[model samples]
Target: MNALPNIVDSETGQGLPRYDLRVENHGPSDLEFEIWQIPYNGTPDVKKPLRISGLRGRNLALIEHRVLRLLAKAGIHLGGLNIQDQARYALNEDQALNLGLLFRTLAPMRNRENMPMVADGIEAMGKEEAAYWLGMAMHRKYPRRVLMALRFLLIDPKARMKD
Candidate 1:
């Protein structure tokens, strides 16, 4: 059997059994903060939905590998599904809708490499097409921060910096 990866806690460096991330308000204000755990690889049969309180009372999907990585960095572990398993079962339509709303509100930052993918999916495409591809990527990654960055790109094509 393939051994699971040992994702260390960003702050503590302790090994984690599973990984999960939660969004909370940093202070009394509405600003959102991401709390995460270490990464692990396991079966998807035990995966569960992630609840983020600061996201306007919506539960965010947590089935993407990247999302797992982000969570691991913060010290979270999914109970059942590992990174690979999450990649297999991406988000559904309703999840995508919720993610879109979160993305619009969060407007987080992302890596530069992913910008092109977002651009290719949006430029010259109709609104429906743009939404579809963006939705697909969002479902696959479930990285709310990255999705928010992509949402910004979608809203303003020319605003994104060139790769």
Candidate 2:
């Protein structure tokens, strides 16, 4: 099979990806399956969407893996502090809102590369929100490692950067 020629722009020296297009005249059968690189204005950003579309699943996994590691490390470190009873405290509505907001703000920055930002997000929360997160750690529904991490974050947010 013949490869499509590289289509490029004359002015900006930009290039477009090649495509294999086949067209045939069924009645006369004069034309057969073929492809080409035509010089025309095409969607330059078309490949951009294609590149990003396949990244969602992989990116989610990356984020989740990073979060798990981060939380696990936090939990281990906090265990050193030796707060066995792990008392819970009442949370303010505003603090809850702030905690949600913090997650909202960090969701986009998820990934191993953006680990530093995670700590920054935690620190951005007011003391009230941090305290609320500490309470969340006491709940059985939350993963033990992540729960410990949250508790440690409330106590020492700086540990986030260490990851």
Candidate 3:
């Protein structure tokens, strides 16, 4: 498990749950990766949503993967991710929301490298709403970039740059 530090929500006065990046080997060549939320008491939260879009089992991996990709495409490359290794980092809600907002305005054009001429239909979206769009992008599998986006979301703004 690769853990990231917890950040407190300013309004709630409660720290958010720590998150860890985990990868499971499902087959000889198939690897599944996910971001697991670790609440206080140092235990992993195992409550998987019963249903997502009528799908029996769906996880945060899909949306998170897209988020990472969107950030990367926007020229904010949070590097040093190794699919075979596990490491810890730190990320807060504000950071996530900011990244989402960045993607919202600069979201790439449909199935092409260029961006839209005008930011149409783009509005301020909270984290949950942003997540919904991420899932929708994953579900529709459109824009081509969504599916082709990176499959990891391991980023730490505080980490020291490696030489």
Question: Who wins the TM-score comparison?
Answer: 3
Models 1 onward score TM values of 0.24, 0.22, 0.32
lDDT by residue (1-163, candidate 1, tens digit) is 3433454457876643343323433333222323222223332433454332123211222223333443455445554443323211223223333333334433332434443344334334554554565445545656565456555555544444552
> Cα deviation in Å at residue 160, candidate 1?
9.5
Judged by whole-model lDDT over C-alpha atoms, candidate 3 comes out at 0.37
Cα lDDT of model 2 by residue, 34-151, tens digit: 2222232464534331210011233334443443344354341212222222212222223333333333333344345554455455646676665466446434485455544653
Question: Whose lDDT is greatest here?
Answer: 1
Model 1 spans > 4 angstroms off:
1-26, 30-46, 51-101, 104-106, 110-135, 139-153, 156-163
**Across residues 1-163, which tens digit of lDDT does each residue of candidate 3 receive?**
4334456667877656444333343434333433334455333343541111110012222234554564455444435544454433333443343343334324332422122111112223457755655455445746345423321121222332441
- Model 1 clash number: 16
How well does candidate 2 score on lDDT at residue 148? Answer: 45
> Where does candidate 3 have its weakest 10-residue lDDT segment?
49-58
